[model samples]
Target chain A: MSINKDTIVAIFLLLFCGIMINSSFDIEDPGYQGMKASFWPTIVLCLLSVMSLVMLIKSMVSTTDNNLNSENTNSQNIFLKFKNASICFLMFILFLAFLDYLGMLIGGVLFVFGLLTLLGGFEIKKIINHSIISIITIGIMWSIFTFGLKVILPEGEILRIW
Target chain B: MIDVILQAFASIVLDPVTLGLMFVGTLAGILAGAIPGFTIAMGVILTLPFTFGMTAIQGLATMLGVFVGGFSGGLMSCMLTGIPGTPSSVATTFDGFPLVRSGRPGLALGLGLWSSFFGGMISAVILVALAPQLAFLGLEFGPWDYFSLIIFALTITVSLSGGNITKGLIAGLLGLFAATVGEDEINGVARFTFGFDDFKQGFAFLPVLIGLFAFSQLLTDVEDDKRAKSPLMSQSGTVVKVEHRQAILIILKRWVNLFRSSFIGIFTGILPAAGGSISNILAYDQAKKASPNRSNFGKGEYDGVIAPEAANNATAGGALIMMMALGIPGDIVTAVMLGALMIHNIIPGPTFIQDEPLLAYGVFIAFFVAHFFMVGLQAFSLRIFLLVTKIPMYVLASVILAYCAIGVFALHNIVFDIWVMFFFGVIGYFMKKLGFPLAPMILGVVLGKLAELNLARATGISDDMLLFISRPWSLFFLLMAVISVIFPFYQEAKKETLFAKLYVPVSMIVLSLPLFLMGSPVRMIVAVILVLTGAYFLYKRTSSLKIT
Candidate 1:
C-alpha cells in the first residue's frame, strides 16, 4: 500500500495539468483569425496529462510487480540527505527577499559569505577565507556591472546615494 | 570575387588597429561566453556602441571576432563547470563535464577547441562559396515548413530522454507549457496567467536556462559538506594541459562526425530563426545515432563534445552568410549584427554583393580570420579558465550563483527573472533526482515560442491543415520528423523488426518525393539517386528474405 516517489510526482503533475486545462477555458477565444490562444496550451497540457498518467500506471505496475518497500524506506532518507541543499536554498531565498533593502553590493557579499560558511564550515580560518572571497568577488562584480557595463545595481532604499 | 576577397583580406590584415580591435573583441567574447548567463548576443550588443566610431569593415570585423570567439568560449565553462556558458553549448556540457570528471579534461578541452576551429573553417569556406545558393534555400521555407522543422527538432527529446521516455516527454511538455504561460504573442490573449502581472511577460529563455543548468547544477555540487569543500575537478592539483595534438588526431580520425556535425550546424544556421541552439542538439543527436560507441555518449564520449562544439561554431558562419547575402538575420546575434550594418548605412540583400563587393568580402574574411584568432586566443585564455577548477566548490558555487542572480537581473532589470531562475533551479534539481532528462525540456523551452509562432502564422494564412503535409518543404520536414521519431526505436531494434528493416529504404523513398517536387534540376537528380538507392536496398532485402 506504500506509494513510491514516482507515483506521488505523477499524481501531482496530473493534477497540475488538470488545473492548467481548466484555466485554458477561461482564456477569451476572441474569434480572431488562426487558432485560439488556448489551443496550443491546451494541446500541451493534454499531452502532459497523458504522459503523467502513463508514468503513474507504469510506476504502479512496477511497484506491484516488485512489491519493493525499499523506495518507501528510502523516501524518508532523501529528506535527511537534502538538509545542506535545503539550507543553502533557503539562504538564497532570504538573500533575494532582502535584496532591495541591502542592495546587491551588501546582499551579494553576505549571501556568498553565508553560503560559503554553510557549505565550507564554521571555522575561524574558513570564515576569514569566505569573507575575503565574498568582498573581492562581489566588489569585482559590482565594479564591472556599474562602471564597465554601466548597468545600475540596486543601491538599496536605506543606503540610497547618487 | 577573387579580387574582392583579396582586397578585403588585405584591408583587414594590413591594419594593426583593426586586427588589435578584433583580438580584443575576441577576448571579450570568450569572457562573456564563459559566464553562465552572459550570452553572445549580449556581448555583441555591448560591442555595438564601440563599433559605431569605426569604419564599416573595421566595425564588422570586430563584431565578427566577438561572434566567432563567443561560440568557442562557451565550451570552456561547459567543460570546466558542467554549466553551459551559452545555450548553444548546452549539449557540449553533456560529454565535456563528464570527460573532465573522468580525468580527461585536457582531451575534452582540446577536442572542443579544435572541433570549433575546424567547424568554423568549414562553414566559412561554405559561406564564401555558396552564400547566395544557401540563402535562397532559406527563403523557400514557409510557416508550415518552419513548424514542421520544429516538430522534427522536437524529436531530439526522444534521443535525449535516455532510459525514461515517459519522464522525458512529460518534461518536454512542461517546457512547452511554460512557454505558453504569458500573453499569446499572436492574439495578445493572457494565458494561464491567473491575474499575476509578472506572468504576462512569460518566462524568458535565459533565466530558465541558467536556473535549470547552472543553479541546479550548483545545488547538486554542494549537496553535502565533503563535496562542497572539494574542488570542481577531483584531480585539481595536476597540471592540466590542452592536449592539442592528440585531440586534433582524434578529430581527424572522426572526420565523418566532424563533417556531418559541421554541415548540420551550417544547414540549421541558414534557416532564419533556427540557430546554434537547435543545430548543436541536432548534431549531438545525429552523432549519438551514428556513433559506434553510442552508449558512451552521455558518459564523456569525445564525439559528443566534438559534435556540439563544432556545430555551434559552424553556426556563426552559416548565420553570417544569411545576414550578408539575404539581409535576413539568422539568429539574435546576427540580428544584432544586422543592426550594426544598418547603422553604417549598409543594406544587405540580393544585390548587396554587387553593390558592396569589398564590404561583403570583408565580412567573409572577417568571419574566416576570426576562427584563427579564436583558436590562438583560446589556447591562452583556457589556461586562465582552468584556474577555476582550483577554487573550492563552495566558493565557486556561491560566486557563480551571485553572478547568475546579477546576470538575470541585468537582463531586464527585473527581480522576477531572479525568482524564475530560483524556481526553475528547484524544479530542475528534482527532475534530475527523478531521472527526468533536462535537455529535452530545455529544447522544448527554446523551440516552443518559434513553433507556436510558426503554427499560428501557418494557420492564419489558411485553415487548410493539409498544407502542413502538402507543401514541398513542409512535407519534407514532416517526413524527416517521422523518420527522426522512429530513429531511436529503430536504433534499439536494429533490423530485427520489419519496420527497422524497411526504415532506411522507406525513409529514402519518402524523403526523395519532396526533393523531386522541389522543381530544380539538381534536386530532381538528387531525388532520383535517392530513389535508386532505396530501390536497390529494397531489392536486396527481398532477395535475402526469399533465400531465408
Candidate 2:
C-alpha cells in the first residue's frame, strides 16, 4: 500500500485524541457497567491502530519485491507527492474554516473556486464559469434544503434577516 | 398475496408523492448513470445520508428510482459513445457502440432502451409477485445463515480482488478483521476500543463508503488529469430507426437469452455481495455460452446488448425485495438503502411487511411507475442526449466533487462532516491504490455493529454463553460461518494441487483448542476451520513466491 505512513499515523492520532477528549466528558459518571458506551469503539480504535501498526511494520520490514520487476517498483517524486497532498489537506482545512465562518453557500463558492484555481490552474474563463455555476448551484441547493426539506443550513449574515 | 399486489398497485398508482418522486428519481438517475465515470453505486452511497430525514417509503422510493434510472442510463453512453457508461453496460457498449459507429445509433438506442425496459419490467413484476415468498425464506435464516451469507459475500472478493489469491484473502481477512474492531455486541465488552467514544459507536459506514469510492476516485483523478478531473463522458451521434417488425423479431429471437440473463440478474441480486456488475458479467458470459453465434457475441450481437442490460436492470428489482422486506441488503445499493431505512427508524423484515404492507407495496408501485416514466420520457430525449455525448469527463468530475462537498455540508449544517467526507475520500483513494477491497471492508463495518448487537442479545452470555448458538436459527448461521471462513483457502489449495492438498486436513485436527474455548459450539466450528485454512494459506504463501 502506497498510503503514506504519516496519513495513517495522523488518522490514528486523531482517533487517539478523540478518545482522550471524549473520555474527559463526564469521567466521574458511572457509565454502562461492565461496558461504558465508549467501550466498544475504544476497543475498535486500538485494534484498528494495531492493525495499522502491523501494516506499517510489514511495509517497513518487507524487502523490495520490486527487485523482480522494474514496473512493479514504485519510485515517486517526493516534491510532487508532498505538494499534492499538502494542497489537498489545505483545501479541506480551508473549506472547514470558511464554512464554519462564512456559511455554506458563500464559503462553498470560494472553496470550489479556490480549489480549482489553486490546485488545477485552469484558465481564467473556466475559473469564472466554475465560480458562477458553483454559486448558482449552491443557491439552488440552499433553497432545496431550507424550503423543500426544511433542513436548517448555515445562514450567513446575508440571510439572517429573513 | 393478492392483497399485497393490490396494496402495491393502489399505493403506487394513486399516491402522488410516491409516483412523483419515483419519476423524478428515475429521470435524474438515468442522467447520472449515462454520464461518464458516474456510477450508480456512488450515487446510492452519496444520497444515503440525505435520506436520513425522509420517511421510509419516500426515501426508499427515491433510491428505487435512482436504481432503475442508473441501470438504464448506461445504455445512453453505449448507444452514443461506444464506451459503456457503467461497468454493467460493458457488453452493451460492444454491440450498441458498434451500431453508433456504424451510423445506426438510433437502432442501437432503440434496442438498448427496449431491452433494458423489458428486462426491468419483467424482473420487477417477478419481484413484486414473489418478493414476499423470498422474504419468508430470508426470515427462516438464523445467525449462522447470515454469518454464512456474509462469508459468501466476502468470498466473492477473492474472485474480484485482482489476480493474487493471497492478496484477495488478506484483503478480505482485513475487512473481516476490521469488522471486529468495534464493540463486542454480545458482551458489551469493548473488544478493541482504546477508549475512543466514536470507536464505540463503531466506524461510520457512509463516511467509509465515501472514502473508498469517492475519495479514492478523486485522488486517482487528481493524479491522472494532473488533478483537474472531469466526471463527464464525451460522445457523438443520435439514435437510428429500426423497423417495428424487426424490433419485435429481435426480442423474440433473443427471448431465451434475455430470460436467462434476467433470472441470473434476479438471483444475483438476491445474493449479498454480488451486485449488478457481477450479474452483468455473468449474464453476458451465459449469453455467449448458450449462443450458437458465440464468436459474434463481442462484435455487436444483439444478445451482447440484451444480456447485461437485462441482468443489470433485473438485479436492481431483486435487490429491493431483500432490502425492503428482509432488512438485509444483497449489495451496496441496498446497503445504502439499509442506512436510509434506519434514518426513518423503520426496521425491515417480516415485521415491516406485517406492520406496513402499504409502504412495502407502495414501493413496488414506485419501481414500476419510475421505469414507465423513464421509458416514456427517454423515448423523446434519446436523440438529444445521444448527440451531446462528447463532453469531457474531467468537467463532469469537478461538478460531482462540488456536489459531494455541498451534500456533506447540507447534512447537519456542519463543516465537520464535510471534513469527515473528505477524510474518508482520501482514505478511500489510498486504500484502492493499495489493492484492498473497500466494499467488503465497508460491508464488514456496516454489519459488524449489527452482528455484534444481535450476538450480544442472543447470548445473554454473561449469564450463559453456551446458550448463544443453541437455538436452531443461530446454529444454522453458525455452521455456515464455520464453512465460510475456511472454504476460500481450501478452494485455493484444491485448485492448485489435487493429491498433496489432502494434508490440508491435518492442521484442522491440531488447532481445535481456541475455538473450543470460545464456548459456542457454532463458533468453535468456525475456529477450527479458520486454523486449518490459515495454516494452509500460510504454506501456500511460502511456497508460491510468485505474486501472480
Candidate 3:
C-alpha cells in the first residue's frame, strides 16, 4: 500500500488549488466591473484542479497496473538524499534574511565562503582557498555594481558610516 | 533612401567617438546578457542615461549596439551552462546545453553565434526595406486576434511536455495561476493575496525566471556532494574553440530553416507585447515540427540551437521597425529606446520616417553595423566565457546564486524580489524532480497576463462571442491554435493511421479560410492555390487507400 510520489504531488496540488478556489471568493469585487477580479484566477485554479486530478488518477492506474512501489526506492531516505540541497537552501534563506544587516559586500563574501566550505571541504588549505576566492569574487562584484554601473549596493544598517 | 542610408552609415562609422561608445555599449551588453537574472532591457535602460549627453545618432547607435549585443550575448551562457542568461535564450538551452554536455561546446557556440548574425542581418534588411508596410501589419490585430494568438502560443505546451502531458498541463496551469495572484491591472483588485501585502505584487517575472531557471538549476548541480566539487563540464583536458568554419557550413546547409526562423522572429517582434521570448520559442517549435530529426530536438539537435538563437536576435530588428515607423514599442528594450528618442526631442509616428529621415536611417544602419560588431566581439569574449566551465560546480553555483540575488535586488532595489526568487527556486526544484517540464510553465507565466488582458478586452468590447469567430485574424489564429494543439499527436501517430494521412491536407484547407477572408487579391490567390493543392493531396490519399 505504498503511495506513488506523483500521487502525493497531485494530491498536494489538488489541495492547494482547493484552498485557492475557496479564497477566490473572499476577493473584494468592486461592483463596477464587466468581469470580476476573481474570474481569471478562479478559471485558472479550476483548470489546475482538473489537471491535478487527472495526474492523480493516471499515477494511481499506472501504479496499480505495474504493481510497482516506485516511491519505496527513493522515499526511504529522502532527507539524506536531499541533505546538501536542503543545507544550501537554508544558507540561501539565512543570507537573504540578514542581507540588510550584514550588507551585500560582507554578506556576499560570507555566503560564498560558507557555501564553498560546505560544498568543497573544510580542510585548512581548502578554507584558505575559499577565503581568498570569496573575497576576490565578492570584491569584484561589489566594485562593479557600486562603481561602474553606479548602482548603490545595500550598506549594512549597523555599518553605515556617512 | 540609398543616399540617406549611406549618410547614416557614414555618420556612425566615420565618427570615432560614436564608434567607441557603440563598442563599449556592445561589450557592456554582452556582460549583462551573459549573467543570469540580468535582462537586455536593463542594459539598454542603464545605457540610456549615458546617451543623453551624446548626439542623437551617437545615442541611438550606442543603445542599438547594446540591444543587438544583448540578444546574442545570451547564447554564451545558455550553451556553457544550462541556465538561460536572458528570457529570450530559454529555448537555446533545450539543445545548446545538451550539445555542450555531448562535448561539442565549440560547435554549439559557433552555431549560436552565426545563427544570431544571419538572423540579425535578415531582419535588418527587412527593417530597412519594409518598415512601414510591416508596421502596418501590427495594427491589424484586435483583442480577439491577440487572445486567439496567445491561445495558439499556449499550444506549444503539448510539444514541450515530452511524454508527460498531464504533468505539463498542470505545470502550465500553475504558472497561469501564479500570474493571476497579483493585482488585476484593469481593476485594482487583488485576487490571491490572502491579506498579505507582499503577495499583492505577486511574483516579479525576472525573479521567477531566475529562480526557476538559474537558482533551481544551481541546486540540482550541487545536489550531489562529489559532483559539486568537480568542474561544470567533463571535457576538462581539451581547449575548447569555436568551430567557426564547421558551424558556418552547417548553417548554410540549413538556409531555409535559418530564413524561416528569422521571419518568425521578425513577425513576432512586429506585434506589440510579443518579444524575443515568444519569438525564440515559436521559432524552436516551428523548427522542431519541420525538422526531419525532430526527436533529436531536446537531445542536442543543431536545428534547436539555430532556430532560437537566430529568432531572438532577429527580434530586435523587428522591434525597431515598429518603434521607428509606428511610434510603438515592440518590446521592453525598444520601449526604452523609444524613451531615449523622445528625450532627444524626436517623436516617432506614421510620418516619423518622413520627418526624421537621417536619424531613422541612422537607426537602420546602426542596427546592421551592430550585428557585425556583435559577431566580432562575441568571437573574442566567447573564449573567456568558455573558462566558466572550468570552475567547480559548487563555486559556480554559489557565485551565480549571489549574482542572482544582486541582479534581482538591483532590478527593483527591494528585498521582496530576493524572497520571490528563493520561493520559486524551491518550487522549480521540486517540479524538476517530479518530471514536470519547466518550459511549459515558463511559457504560461510569460503569456498568461497578455492572454487574460486580451480575453477581458475582447469580452468587454462586445457581448456577442461570435465576434471571436467572425473576425478574420481571430479565426486565423484559432485555426492555427487547433492545428498546433494536434500537431504533436499527428507527429507521434503511425504512418498507416488515417489521421496522419489527412493531417497535411486538412491543415492546408482549414488554414486557407483566413487567407480567403483577408480580401486581398494576392492572399485570395494564395488561398485558391492552397485549396487546389490540398484537394489534390486529399484525392491522391483517398485513391491510394481504396486500392490498398
Candidate 4:
C-alpha cells in the first residue's frame, strides 16, 4: 500500500511523543541533578514535537499529488527500489564473507571482479581484464594500507592454509 | 603576517613525509570525489582504518587532500553532464551542463578549477587572520546555546522537507529518537536496550550514515533505474565523447560571482555544522538572490555554475579554522581528522596550534599543492570521471549495496551494525518515499551526543535542568532558536490569519524575549540586526507566497 505523507509523519509524531513521555520518567539522583542528561534530551524532543505538529497540519491541508491519483504510482515502482539496493547489500555480504577467507588481496580482487561482472554484466573476457586491473590496483592499496600505513586485514582462509 | 605564513609554508614544504602525504592525500581524494556517491569525508572515514598505521600529520594531511579534491572533482560531473557528482555540486549542474551543451567543457572545467582555488586562498587568508578571535568566542558558548543551535539546525531541515514539512520533522525526530537507543549518554542507563548488551554503544554513527545515505540512495537509484524506459540504460556500454576548447578567459570573467559566493561559502564553512552540501546550496541561493538577472537562473546561467562550484570547494579552507582552533569539527570530514589525531594521541584544541605549529602549517601548504594537483590531474583524466558516470544503472546499484555493507562492517567488525544499517535503510527509504529529508536525521544523530554531554556539563548538577539557561552564550542560542522556530509559523500565518495580521507586532516583541535577556550587549546588537534581516525575508516570502 502506498503510504501517505500524513501517515508517515503521524507515526513520527507518535514516536517522538512516546519517547518524550517515556524519557520524562527519568529523574536522576540529587548530586548528579544539576547536569542531569535527560533534561536536555527532553527539551530537544519537546521542540521536535511542536515542529512535527506544525508539519502535520501543513501536510494534511496540502494539495493532492499523492497516489490517490494513479499517475504518481505509474512513475514510481516499489520493487525497482528494492532491486538496486539489494545488489549493493548482497555484494557487501560477499565482501565480508570473503574478507577473511581469501586474504585481503585475493578477497578484494574477487569482490571487485564479482561485483563488476555480476552487477556490471561484463562478459567473461572483460571480466578477466577488469579483474586483472582491479587486482593490481588492490595490490597497491594492500601495500599502501598494510605495509606503509599499517592497517590490519583479516588473514582469512588463505593464511590459515598456508 | 606574511613572514609567519611563509615560515609555516617553508616548514611544511621541507618535511618529506608531509610532502608525500599531501600528494597521496590529494590524488586519492580526487579519485574519491570524482566518482559519484563517494564523499570526501566518506572516503576518509572508509580509509580511517588504514590511517591507524600512520602518524597524525600523515593521516590528517591525506584526509584533507581528499576533502579538497572531492569537493573540487565535482565540477567534472557538472561540466560534462547535468548531474552533480556530489550533492554539493547540484548548483553547479545549473550552468555547468549548459556550458557543456554550449560546447565549453574546458571553460567549465577551467572556471571551476581556478575560482575554487582562488576561493580557497581568500578563505585561508581570512582564517589565518581571524580564527583565534572566532575560536575564543565559540568557547564562550554554553549548554543552552548548543541546545538551541542544534534545534535551529534541526529546524532548517524542515524547510528542506519540500511541501510536507511535518514528514521531514518526523523523520528527523525519529532520528533523534533513534539516538536514545543502546546506552544512555549520561548515567549509563539503558533507555531502549530492550535487554541486549549490543545496545550499549548505541547505533554506530558511520554505519547508520552509510545505511541512510548510501544504502537508501541505492534503493532509490534502483527504483529509478527500474523505471527507465530507455533500452540503452540497461545495455552495459562505454561511450566517451569530449569536444570543446578549454576556455580559461571565461573562468576569469565569472570571478565576480565566483568571489562573492566564495566569501559566503568561507563564512558559512567557518561555522560549525555547515558542510559542503549546505555551503553549495546557500551559495547558489545567494547568487540567485543577489543577481540582477534572476530569470537566467536554473536555465544555465554562468553565475549558477560558478556560485556553488566555488563555494562548495572553498569551504574546505573555512572548516580548517574550527579544526585547528577549537577541537570542534565543522563536519564529518574534520571529525575523522579528529579521530586520526586521537589515534596518535595528539590532542586538537588551542594547544594543537602552539605545539604542532609546523604540522598545522604543513596541512595548509598541502591544501595549496593539493588543489593544484587536483585541477591538473582532472583536466587530463576527464575521461575517467565521465566514464564512471556512464556505468549501467543496475551495475551501479549493486556497487552501492556492496559499499553499504563494507561501510557497516568497517565500524566495529560487528554484524550488529549490519542490522542497524538495514533498519535505517528501511527507515530512510520510507522517509524518502514519504517526502522526508534524510539530512536532518543524520545531523540529529551526529549532534545528539554532543548536546547531551555539553548540557550535562553545563548543569554541573544532576538535578538542576534549568542551569542550562543561566549562562550567557547558552541563553543567546536558546533565544535564537526560539526565534528560528516561531518565525516560520509567524511567516506562514501572517497571510492566512487576521489574528496574526493584527497581533504580529506585539507577538514579535514577546517572541523576542530571549534577546532582551542577553548577557553580552554585543550579542544583543547582532540579534537586533538579525531580527530586522529575518523580518525582511519573512515578509517577502510570505507576501510572494500569498500573492501566488
Q: How many backbone clashes does candidate 2 have?
A: 37
Give Cα distance to truth, residue B517, candidate 2, Å. 24
Writing each residue's lDDT as its tens digit, candidate 2 over B1-548 gives 57876877876767787677677677767866776566887767666655656667777887878888889888887667676777778777766677666666556676777777778888889887787776776676654445444454555544443443334444444444445544554444443456666555444556656666775675555555443443344335445564345654687678998899999998888766667777888888888888889887656788887888889889888877777656777777787777776657677765666677877777777777777776775755455455435444444444456667666655455555566677667666665655556666666655656554544343332445454455444444445445544555565565445333533444454345434654777857787687778677667655754446
**Candidate 3 Cα misplacement greater than 4 A, ranges:** A1-3, A63-68, A75-81, B1-119, B127-132, B157-163, B234-367, B382-386, B546-548
Task: Give me the candidate number with maximum DockQ.
Answer: 1
lDDT (C-alpha) at residue B404 in model 1: 79
| Model 1 accuracy (lDDT, Cα) | 0.81
- Evaluated on chain A only, model 3 obtains a TM-score of 0.88
lDDT of 3 by residue, B136-219 (tens): 564687888877766665555545346576777787788788888878886888878877898887786667766776678778
- The residue pairs in collision within model 3 are none
Task: Please identify model 4 stretches exceeding 4 Å from their true place.
Answer: A1-9, A12-77, A90-149, A157-162, B1-12, B31-49, B93-105, B157-164, B183-186, B225-258, B270-306, B319-363, B393-426, B461-470, B486-548
Clashes of 4: 18
Query: Judged by lDDT relative to the true structure, which candidate is superior, 1 or 2?
Result: 1
Provide the overall lDDT of each model, using Cα atoms, as 2-decimal numbers. 0.81, 0.64, 0.81, 0.64
- The runs of at least 3 residues in candidate 2 whose Cα sits more than 4 Å from the true structure, single-residue gaps closed, are A1-88, A119-122, A157-162, B1-7, B49-53, B141-205, B226-231, B239-245, B380-394, B461-496, B499-548
